[model samples]
Target: MKYANNIAAIDELSASEGVFTTAQAQRLGISRNALSHACKVGRLERVAHGAYRLSGAPSSETDELAAIWKLTASTAFSWERQAKWDGVAVGGSTAAWLLGIGDFHLSPYRIYAPERINSKIESARFGVRNVDEGDMAWMGGLPVTRAERTLADLCLDCEDPSLVEGAFRDAAAQGLIDSTKLGSLLDELGESKRRAALLEPLARALSASDQKGQS
Candidate 1:
């Protein structure tokens, strides 16, 4: 089953935004030998120990995040490790920018890494914070915090809520996350009352977008 250029194989590879793992290749009916052959001849480029990228794929900042998924979540590992790390997701203001939701891009992109192994990010600006319930989702092929989660996490990391309100509004207006989900999450906030401010701007932005849409 060496369909290296098979449309389905290519689609599967591209879905990870050009990043894939050995397990992913196997599922795509690409044998390990086929994988080695592809890399040997230049169709794929090996990344790190167990990741590969389609040769000539366009570069992207999300590439780093995608690489994380390939190496961590997608790698072959014990069942316990998979279950434990399933909640890991890229979070904080950097996540907003990564999801095209806001302009709150900061160096050392933050990730909610509860327990990481061999996870040395090359960028100095990349930061890791310990958090529970790191729910994740796909954002244009990158593993990222859910839209609502991203906003909530940003609020915790923000110094001035006013500064990031516009970004929150933009995200809400774009309908990137569900209001109900956000409400539920907010309700769970133990002492972080400041996050409540996000709701107002989100409502206003969604309202404005709705009115504009109708008019």
Candidate 2:
């Protein structure tokens, strides 16, 4: 099959973000060999196995995660997928970093998915969990754990107590999350030592933020 507007079609598939999976290409009737040919001729750049970015497509910070997420749906187009498709979400420290909640520039990108994704990409660590709708948000078409949920999840997974404290303070200070809701969630998570340690600092931070706002 031939497409007169091949690059245009790919642009649409990538949502103008410059990264797409082979499955997306196939949906447009562009075959694996065609993608290879495009790459060989400098029209496309293969970033990962079964993943390609248009050579001329502009770059963005979200490109890497978006590419990997698309691989989760190898044979379906984005619109064809369910509204909360596959229960995939960017969570934990990575979510905090994306939201600029704290000083976190973590590698081995943290992800939450309903099942294990055996992709060739090795730079990510996936946790199997169901992300509730209210606990997640969409950023540039990528699903992410919302601020409260991100911090709550971090409190559970982050090894460094200080990091969680910093994220919690940042989220509270910046009004990125509802302290009341987060407090309830932490309580529901039970009275672990970590939760206890976080609660005191969270109270102090919120108190300071409130005073500053009033002043």
Whole-model Cα lDDT of every candidate shown, in order: 0.61, 0.73
Best by lDDT: 2
Least well predicted 10-residue stretch by lDDT in candidate 1? 75-84
lDDT of 1 by residue, 1-215 (tens): 53646545755665544777777667667677777877887877776556677878776666555556556666443233434555556777767777677777643656666564455666423345444554566566445677777766766665345645666677767777676666666566524455555444544544565687679
Q: Give the Cα error of residue 18 in candidate 2, in Å.
A: 3.7
TM-score of 1: 0.58
Error of model 1, residue 78, in angstroms: 15
Error of 2 at 54 (Å): 1.2
Q: What total of clashing residue pairs does each candidate reach?
A: 2, 0
Listed in order, each prediction's TM-score against the native is 0.58, 0.82
Model 2, total clashes: 0
Which pairs in model 2 have colliding backbones?
A: none
